[model samples]
Every structure is written in structure tokens, then in C-alpha cells.
Target: MEQAEIGLIGLGVMGSNLALNIAEKGNKIAVFNRTQEATKKFYAEAGALQSQIIPCETLEEFVAAIRPPRPIIIMIKAGDPVDQQMELLKPYLSAGDIMIDAGNANFRDTMRRFDSLKDSPLTFIGMGVSGGEEGARHGPSIMVGGTEESWKRVEKVLTSISAKFNGDPCVAWLGNDGAGHFVKTIHNGIEYADMQMIAEIYGILRDGLKLSAPEISKVFGNWNTGRLNSYLIEITEKVLAAADPITGQPMVDVILDAAGQKGTGKWSVIEAQNLGVAATGIEAAVAGRILSSQKAERVEAEKILGLPDTLAFPAVDGVAFLKDLESALLAAKIGAYAQGFAVMAAASKEYGWHLPMPTIAKIWRAGCIIRSQFLDEITSAFTKDPDVANLIVTPAFAALVKETDGALRRVVSTAALAGLPVPALASALSYFDSYRRSRGTANLIQAQRDFFGAHGFDRVDGVDKHHGPWGSGAAIY
Candidate 1:
């Protein structure tokens, strides 16, 4: 029996782990790296795992070793390296061969590559691999953008290596051109908003109540048992509770407040602005990171104008505070998801992808870095109404917000009174309020438009008139 052959280029963290995963699944793998030492190390580690892998000395040797109808996965850097790798492989690749780029390349580049390779018999796929290093070793959520014919040929391998989300494999053909990268970009955006919201909660607990990291961690752990449970929150609790190896204090205290952001968060915010979708949570999160990086300004403020000391909430009702915090967190989380979904919807329409929103939700339920119970509700929301404009406006979700909004407001007000920063969460609630009350501002907007555009105005009874410069109303002829 002839064995299936797969080759992986660029033995970096993600590539090496993914190569091991594929080899462990009983397929023969030909691994290549720029440095022979790195390739040898991968071979050693994978060999220890009893994997069936062959480390090739050269790209030519690797290509010659692979079997016919070859599927070669490229996991190198996104930009020029991807093109260079493709150029190197193009000569060795035969007709009907497959090439998959699993890096975080820009969608435009992917589209360009797709067009460039169209005339050739060789197949190209722009695939999105999520869940980080751990997921790469185990199973990550995979998004492929290519022809159905190519997807069919490699579907089994993808399914085997993809994480199971709600009993289905997390890998799927996300339409043609740039769909995979587009979805992954939005996924990272959602992750940014989610992480920021959790940080805001931590700030609220630490600053408002003067609680230690462990105390706030315990609260998060408790919340994990309910609907508020999520991957981000779960990881946050671990971060808070983890003690430093030497100092024995919580590890979070030693970490810098400034967070580094990859370009995806900025891309999402920019795309949202272009699409005219309200992505307040993600935008605020990005802005917060920028402000954190301005440490010199902050230090000057602290020295010249003393900042307020942390305030302590009354110790009489700890449970009440916890409940309020949980409610606020839930509300904020929903708003973030809503914003992300809204962006997806707009992108789908703009790009003509017709992406299945419900499927997107279901696939995000596991394996991916952003996996959470909240996705189940989002899936349910879209399943019930495919045309549902926003997740927050869904009947059940609206009821949830109605029940929790008061608590969220109270928490934000208390944080303000205590001079605590809860920027991400507060912004989420503000967006929710703005979205829900959008209908109420139509009259105000109409008046402003009449004042500027002189576009005429309509009365409450639906009578239209053009008001002249003197404010004299003239009926339309």
C-alpha cells in the first residue's frame, strides 16, 4: 500500500508542532527548514514521539521524497517569505499538486496569489490556523480558502488535524480567495476585545475594592461555573492566581500594564470603520493599549498632579459586589460578541462571501483561542434567525441584557466613584445603550440634517416640507 506523503516548510513553533500532529496521525511527513540544525531538532523531538517523519537536507530532496498528488503545507512568515517559498517550490511541484499557506498573510495577498496560480494545474489554499502553539500540537481550528476540488482532495487530513467544536471538525472551506484570513482577522479582533474586557474587570476588582489578585481570581473561578464561563476568563483567573516562582507574590503584579498588539486588532477596527459598524469594544481596547504605552506622560502626571489613592468599598456586602461584577462582565462580553458578529455580517455582505454566521459561531465553540460558552448562545441566535442583524438584539439575549444592564451601570458608577479604570467594559455597555436607543435619536438627527443639508424635514404625522433659510416652511410642489 502506498503511503500518503505531506511536506512542511519552515519548522518554527507552529509549523514544527503541526508537523508532529500530522505525523502522529500515521501519515508520512517530509520536514524542511532553512537551518539544518532546526530541522534536525524537529526530527529528534518528533522521532521521540514515535512519529513517521523524514527530515530532508534540501527542498529538492523533500519534493523528490513526497508521493504523487502531493500536499505541501507552507508555514513560513506571511509576506515576502511566502512568495519566495512558493517560487522555490513551483519548479519542483507537478501538475495536480497542492500548496497550503497556513500563515497569517493579508487577504489581499492571498487573493493575488490565487489569481496568479489560477492558470496552473497546481492548487493553492490560503488557510487560517488558530489556537496557538498548544493547539498546533493538539488540534487547532482551521479555515481554508480555495476551490472545492482542492478542498475535497485534502479534506480528510484537515478534519483529522482540526479540533472538534460541538461534535464537528473545526476545519471548513471558508469560500474562495481571502475568506480564511478575513475570518481569522476578525477572530483576533474578537480576542482583543475579550481580553481587554477581562483586564477591565481585574482593574475594577483591584482598584474599586482594593482586593488582591488571588481574591479577584477566586471570584472569576466561581463565575466560571455559570453562563459567564469562557476561555479568556478561565485563563485570566489562572493569570491572577499564579504566584511568582521566586517572590511568591501573584505573577500578574510583576507583569507590565502595557500590552503588545499584532496588526489584526487594528485591521478589524479599520475594517469596522469602513463598513460603518460599531466596534466600540475592540476600538477601546486598542486605544487602552496605546494609552498604557504612554508611561512617561503617566509618570509626569503622578509626580506633578497626584493621582487618587485606591478606594475601598464597604466590606459589609462582598457577595453583592461579586454579583454586580459578574453581571457587568456578562453584559460587556455580550456587547463585544455583538460587535464582532456585526462586523462579520457587514464583511460578508461587502465581500460577497455569504458566510454562515451560525456556523462561524459553532466552529468557535472549541479549540480556538477564543472558545467560549458564549459562542453557543451566538450560534443559537443565528440559527433562530439567519438575518438577525445583531446578537444583542436577539430576543433571549435582549432579555439577558435587560436583566443585567442595571447591574452593569451600577458597577461602572461604583468604579468611577472609586477612580478605577474600567474602560473596555464601560465602553461595551455604552455601545449597548447606544445601539438599543438608536431609534430615539432619529428626530434629533433629522433636525441636524435639515440645518445642514437643507434636505427638508417630515413631521410626526408624516407631512414633508422644505424649511427656507428664514425658517419659513414651503410645501413641495
Candidate 2:
């Protein structure tokens, strides 16, 4: 039999589906699971695609089935498991063989793995695969980080199996080392903020306006047809509309309020802080999840502290306010996306990735959870000025902010007065406010720092004075 063009080392949901996708795309793939039973079952279930799948029972068999200078995808659990799997596979791989780590790994780990294999004949790739199981079986956005020569060896197959936006493949060789994984981390960070903002809007509708699930579903459906046309918003509509078969209640209504998270969101916040970038919206979203997990504590606290006195939503022009909510959502979304891109920009400089911002935006227009028409607009903005510092200052986005910021201000003010929790939205508003002003309250902070810690401060007048003379709790100057 002809040798398989590529090989895969895991048979979990993502791995199996990805193998099938490769087969469907006319690329013969050799697949092996840790268990022989899984490999056999996956091949048996492949049916028509089985002819393209070579299921191997041993690492030796799997490695021999692939062509020389092999590109093998290791779609196993991240961190320690990935390390262990790489060690196990290394014995079988010859010089020039590529091991692709397609998991949500911390980029620092990815960088170390790449550097560890630098002198070896084998090479490492840190690939970020987004869009979950369904996208894996069809196509997902693929971010590849490896040597340029190594990338060339696998680009065709990756492009063949990636999601397409306007007939363009949603995959790219971002840069060397951990660029792909870093971009993926920012993607998830933005996703957290996006979902939180949507949920905040839903909270206002359900709790403040006392709208039913069906009514809120209708609202989301309407938003999906407008500026907020995104996978998350589209799914939010469906999730609200769905009824649980057991209770015949709205699906979302029956589900627990607590949200669970893997580590990507936290990693994004940590990286942002390390980069000294203000990712307040993403930070608030992660905090929201952390606070959400403390359901028992929250329940007990609410019982003792009671709801805020001004808990009632103020009556207003329903139609006008609804419009305001829509505009507010758009504005908050801009803030979150801008912050995510800013984090990437900083990382690109710090790591010397020189990541293609326009390409990142382009790929995110489809396949990923955060896929949206808005990303197309972002793509356009970045395309015009690849190194524009921040996404919000782009001509198109600046105009958008100008048009929508008033509604955001109004919605935030209203939510505050009604004691509604809109941390992500409020953070976005504050981020925008803080970012735009040439002058800020930081001067007072500088003065306080100097007073307490004797830290020096810069003068606006370009004078030689660096210290604020303080004695007897007064400005001695």
C-alpha cells in the first residue's frame, strides 16, 4: 500500500475528527491511539473514508506508515501529557520529522518545547486549532508556529483542511516558536469577554426588564441579523429558544448560572499583565467566571446582605432603550476586541513574532467561536494599516466608536443605577475612557507614589524636577 502522507497520534474527539477531515480532503492519514481498540474502532467507523485511513496498532507501525520526513500531529492533552507523548514518539521519528502539538498549551511551554528540540534532528510545531469538534470534522481556523522550512512541508494539507472565509483558507504560519498558541490564547480571552458581555445584556433583559426566554431569544435573533452577527450571538439565540425535554423549560433557564473555564482565559490575563497592557474587559470576564464558581458563597452572601435597594429597573421608552442596548453591545464589543488585538500587538513585539494582524483578523472571520462579520471589518482596518498600534484608532473603528459611545455611556449609567452586574461592559467603557484621553488621573497617582515611596515623576513642563518635596504631609515645594 502507498505510504500515508501524514500521521496522527491521538483518537480523542478532536484527533479523530481531524483525521477524518484530512481523509475527506483527499490526504491519506495514518492514525494511532494509545489503545489498539480505539484505532480499530475509529477505522471501522470510518466506513467509506476507511480506505484513506491507516490504523496502526503500534508506534513503530504508525511511524513506518507515514512518508519519510514525516509530519505527525499529536492531538493529546496539553502540558505534561504532550511532553510524555513527544518523548514516546521521538524514538520512532527520524531526522526532519515534525511533531505538531495541536492543543491549548501555554505558549511559554510551547516555546520551551521548540527550543528543547532545536539541536535535535526532529522539529516542533505549536499549532492552535479552534472551532471545537464540529469544526475539526469540517474545517477550523489553524494557527501554525514553526520554522519556515518546516511550515512549507505541511502548509498544503493544513490549508486544505482549514475553514474558508470568502474562498480564502483560515490558516496561516504565524511565526516561529509560540506565536500560534499566543494568538489562540488571545482569541479565547476575547471570547470570554464577548460571551460575558452578551450574558450581561441577557441579564438586563431577563432580570431588569423581566423578559421571558422566548422574548430574549427574539432579541438575540434580531441582533444576529445586525451588527452583532456572530457565532456566539447566533448560538445565544438558539440556546434561549431551546426547551429542555425533561422540564419543558427554556434550556438556558434550567442550566446552572456558574460558568466553567479551562486555563486559556486566565493565561490571557496573566500575559496581558506581564506585557503591561490593560485588558480590563478580559480581566473582568475571567473574574466573572471565578466569582460565578463560588455559587454557594454567593447564595449565602446574598441571603445576608440582601439585594440592593435600587434593584428595580427604571421605566423608560422601551423601544428607544432597546436600541440603546444594541448600540451599547456594539461599543463594548469594540473595546474587548481592541484590547485583545493590543495584547497580540505587544506579544508580537516582545516575542519578535511580527504576527500578521490582518491575517489573524481574517482567519477569525469564520470557523472559530468568535467568528463574526465584525472581524471582517477588523480585517479591513488592519489591512489598511498593519501596525496601527491599536484597533480602536483605525479610521473605521474610530468612526464606529464615535457613533456608538453615547449609547454605551447611557446603558452603563442605567445598569449602575439599577444595581445590575455589567462588569465586562462597564470595564469596556472605562477602558475606552482611559485610553482616549491625552491627560489622565495618573499624575495624582504619581504624586501619591512619590509621597509614599519616594518614586520620581516626570514633569509635563519638561523641567528638571523629578521629585515632589513632601514634609509634614504637605508639598514642601
Candidate with top lDDT is 2
RMSD of candidates 1 onward, in order = 3.4, 1.6
Q: Write the per-residue lDDT of candidate 2 for residues 199-290, one digit (tens) a residue.
A: 99999999889999999999999989999899999999999999999999998989988999999999999999999999999999999999
Indicate the residue-level lDDT of 19 in model 1. Answer: 90
Q: Find the 10 residues in a row with the least total lDDT in model 2.
A: 468-477
Error of 1 at 476 (Å): 26
Candidates in order, TM-scores: namely 0.91, 0.98
- Count clashes in each candidate, considering only residues at least 3 apart in sequence or on different chains: 0, 0
What's the C-alpha lDDT at position 418 in model 2?
97
CA lDDT of each candidate? Answer: 0.83, 0.94
Tens digit per residue, CA lDDT, model 1, 77-111? 88899999999899998998888899987777888
